[model samples]
Target: MWERNLNGKDLQFHLSGINNENFIMKDEQTGSWWQQVSGRAIQGPLKGSQLKRFSHDDLTFATWKREHPSTRILEPDPSAQEEYAPADWEAETAELPVVTPRGKSEPLEDRDLVAGVSNQDAARAYLVADLARQGPVNDRLGTTPILVLPFEDGKSVRVFERTAGGQVLEFFAGTGEELGRLVDATTGSTWDFRGTALAGPLSGSQMARMDVLLDYWFDWRTYHPDTDVYRAGL
Candidate 1:
């Protein structure tokens, strides 16, 4: 998600158009168009301006509620209930044709799901299916060591900087009683999906969470042509 406030002005936006399957938001204040993927204003008065990104998690309701028991869900408006997409929207959309002007099919299929990270002049795409099979992954992006954790459910995922207490840590999948948890190589500390060290020397320590965008390969590649594709053991 992106911050609507820019240059000390809170802007209101609405669906302006679609370009290459991405949403283009037009701010009411300046009439500028912003790209959904990059949050960059591409046209009109605020051309070249960027919106500050807000971090979010795309977790399953069960997982989210387990972690945040008191969280309140936003109820859909009753009047707009009929306007909402059906529960099969995703399945239906998968059969639709896609167009990507600046995307490649190599590395992954256009519609493959990917967990993308873009920071510090670097961008990378991690195949979601591979993440489910590989469990927690330890990798570095632009000098920042990171841990990518895929929950047991196989759908939800999270990324965090592995550096904690001034130490770069490596993590592996927990087994048996420790299943669904992460164990760091340095201290054997067990970490929950929240990136918090739950046991061992680093107990109570928290890994810095990083912003991740769960996107399709075509959309990610179209926006980040130079992005690297993560491969197992490579």
Candidate 2:
């Protein structure tokens, strides 16, 4: 997803009515068209401009409430009908038949949620299930030290650069009562899922944020075919 506003003005977008099956959005302000996944304007006055993407987490209402108790949830429109809801859960268990350009299929199921991270030309996808089993993940992307903190439920993740005060640090999964948090090996500081240092010498510090996307395994690999999948041995 991209920022809705641009250049001191809020821009409105609508789906471009194109014969191609690819998803494209057009801004009403400049009449420019954009690719839905990359948020790059490809046609019209705003061509060559890129949209700034912000990080987001998709999680259950209960989990969100526990983390952000004061946050407000927008209520569904009262006029909306039950038919507008999603299809049956059982029907979503299997991957849907998708037709894309030749040689685009990925190795994982289309419905599996993958936590995607990218740096320059290097990109990787960590299966949410594997992260849940392994706890925090300390890895690198193109020489940039990074940390992946997965929620306990395995449905969401938050990524951050593992640098503070110009020093790179390594992190590991917390033990015992500190299970949900991550502890840096160098500083022994514990960080919450949001990358905030909660205790220890570095308390109150925040990690530099990184853009992470949660998408179907197929969608990620389709957009980034060179992506490496995290396996048990990796």
Candidate 3:
């Protein structure tokens, strides 16, 4: 999510239109158009201005409820129930023809799902299927070391900075009772899906979370053309 307050003004936004399959938001205050993906103002008085992004996660409802039981959810407007998309919207949309240009030599298909991580001016796209098969992935984004963990539920993914206690840590998938957990090689600390150290010498330590965007390969590639694709064992 993005910060709506910019330049001392709290702006309200509405869906203005679509650009390259991404939603365009128009602010009520200045009537400026903002790109949904980049959160940058593309037109009007706020042109060239960028919105600060808030950290968010792409998690299943069950996982979220498990994490935050008392959290309040935003319910849909009862009067506008008919305006909501149906359950098969995603499946139907995926089958629709993509009008955007794509190179035939691209590493992944246009519709392939990817978890994109960006940091320190560098970006990388990790294939969701590869992550699911490989388990926890220890990798670096530019100079920042990162760890990607896929939840056992199969739909949730999280990214965290692997540096903790002045050391870079590598993590592997846990087995047996520790199933769905991450075990660090350095301290042997067992971490849950929340990136919290549950045991070992590093108990009580928390790994810094990073914002990750779960998007289609085409959408991510369209914005981050220079992004590197992560491959297993490479």
Candidate 4:
């Protein structure tokens, strides 16, 4: 009769009697000693022996004492000791929540990809910010940040406008003659003009205009996670 986490939550694990439950029942008349224990295997092969036919309470006591040797010398009755049950109960219970922080390196997607405005609407933000690896921000728009999002048409880059009380009144990343002009030039459901040439496919002029918008986003610090940073290198 063994419990894995006594007074705690765990499977009803069985440990075959490991030749440890040695009981000595003294015989007063014969002056002999009768070693008593259970016949059931608590663990191991049937090679071990414990005098079977013992009461449940007695068997429980023996296993308890075997696991916690200090309890062997002390009387088993809880009433005899004040708060004994509570102390043992607490010792048996698990308090701290089990959390394993190992190997949790999956890439986290940011729900707030639009930057300032979307960030405000989002209740929580998730981006792995680590200077040791991802490094400080580098792009056309900002510095030392873990995430960036491109501007969707009708939406300009927004830098948050905070008040004295730390309340955000609005967002204003930026808008300009160049920015607005490009917005008009591009055509897409998202107003994300890919800048294909009128002649066909992508031409030098179309690609050039695309670069201008990307530079604006980088300068304003509203980074598009989808955009490649390598383009700036050339």
Candidate 5:
């Protein structure tokens, strides 16, 4: 998710049903239009400004509650109960916009989930399935060291920088929740799926979470033609 403000003014957002398939949002303040998926202000006073993005993962509400038990959740509004009904919104299949590279082919399926990591001009994507099978994958993007970890269910993933203090740490997948989801070989700290330490010498400490975009492999490849894909099958 990104911030919704420009020039020190917070712009209220309203879902403009105009482009339901592409995910468009409008600001109540200036009637500016935005693309939610790309976090780009398409039209209006903030056209050139980009929304700041944070590291986020897509998870089921139940899983989220389990991960963050103390998390506060939004209550459904009584007045919009009908609008919020699932039956009111029917699913539609539409092709996402794609821009194929001049000579390269996409390595993964169009709809497969990919955890895309980028630093300035460098980009890399790890297939969710590969991450699940491999457990913790440590690598570098540009000069930044990173680690990719998948949840036990194999559908969710999180990324974090390997740097802590003045040294880089190596990690491996832990047996289960009792020992945490990830264990650092250097310090023996057990880190949860979200990169927070659960037990060991570094208990209660957290790793530096990195910004990652969870997108369809096709969509991510269209944007980053030079991206390297992690493929366990290969």
Candidate 6:
């Protein structure tokens, strides 16, 4: 028989899809639900590490789909994991500072939307990816991923950071001009968006979210051809 330990202080949730196994319990620090939200270890004795936190990136989404027999492997509902991700990036670079979230404006709710996971660690994945794919980059961090079109080269799409403290993701990039046009088109504002959707920041999954976000930005132009915007093109 499998031994089970349940703490009365923390509520338990039986996640059925995870390898047909069970993972549950609430966080002691916060009473938020602790569901397996990220990818597995993939190696080591602890190789199948399940992310028991709400997440949106590829790893988490993939895990969520693999275990669940029915749920489609789509991006985690952006709102569900919005806290860790920012809601705005328009002023992320100019007004924000460092690579992390600071000041009182940063809310705990968004910081640990997924509970146990570290937003700092999640943000770092984005930084590393930017470094590898592109050669040399200038960015910090703030509420969202800042897209600095520093290069005139074909390097239009890049995940720029705001500062070095390592907290926010200014927003995704496709040249600074491209961003201006988007603002002109969408009145939805960054307020309604979160994580990669609104903030342009990457969370648990970096490349996965980055690819989707860029693809989405590009696809939007298809419908607004008459806007006369995007003359520069991505």
Q: Write the per-residue lDDT of candidate 3 for residues 1-234, one digit (tens) a residue.
A: 999989789999999999989999999999999999999999999999999999887888888999999988999999999989898887887797776898879999888889999976799999988888788999989889999988886666899999878899999998898887889999898988888999998998999999889999999999998899999872
- lDDT (Cα, tens digit) per residue for candidate 6, span 153-219: 2222333233322333333333354442211012222311111233323222222222211212112
Report the number of backbone clashes for model 1.
Answer: 0
Residue 223, candidate 4: alpha-carbon lDDT? 27
lDDT of each: 0.89, 0.79, 0.90, 0.26, 0.74, 0.29
Q: How many pairs collide in each candidate, listed in order?
A: 0, 0, 0, 25, 0, 33
Give per-residue lDDT, candidate 5, residue 42.
83
Judged by whole-model lDDT over C-alpha atoms, candidate 1 comes out at: 0.89
Q: Per-residue lDDT of 1-234 in model 4, one digit per residue for the tens?
A: 322231233322222222222333332322333323323323333223333231222123444465457863555676667655574553343232323232233233222121221222221121212211221112332221112222233222212112112221111122453332222112211111222223212222222121122122221122222332222121
| TM-score attained by model 6 | 0.19
Ranking of all candidate structures by their lDDT, best first: 3, 1, 2, 5, 6, 4
> Which runs of model 5 end up more than 4 angstroms from their true locations?
17-21, 76-104, 176-180
Model 5: lowest-lDDT 10 consecutive positions: 87-96
Compute each candidate's TM-score over C-alphas: 0.94, 0.84, 0.96, 0.15, 0.79, 0.19
Between prediction 5 and prediction 6, the one with superior TM-score is: 5
What lDDT would candidate 2 get against the real structure?
0.79
- The local lDDT score (0 to 100) that residue 110 gets in candidate 4 is 20
Q: Candidate 2's residue-wise lDDT over 101-126, tens digit each?
A: 44555566666778999989699898
**After aligning candidate 4 to the native by TM-score, how far in Å is the CA of 169 from where it should be?**
34
RMSD of 1: 1.7
Off by over 4 Å in 4: 1-103, 109-174, 181-192, 196-204, 208-234
Quality of model 5 by C-alpha lDDT: 0.74
Ranking of all predicted structures according to TM-score, beginning with the best and ending with the worst = 3, 1, 2, 5, 6, 4
In terms of lDDT, the poorest run of 10 residues in model 2 is: 93-102
Candidate 2 accuracy as TM-score: 0.84
lDDT of 4 at 73: 59
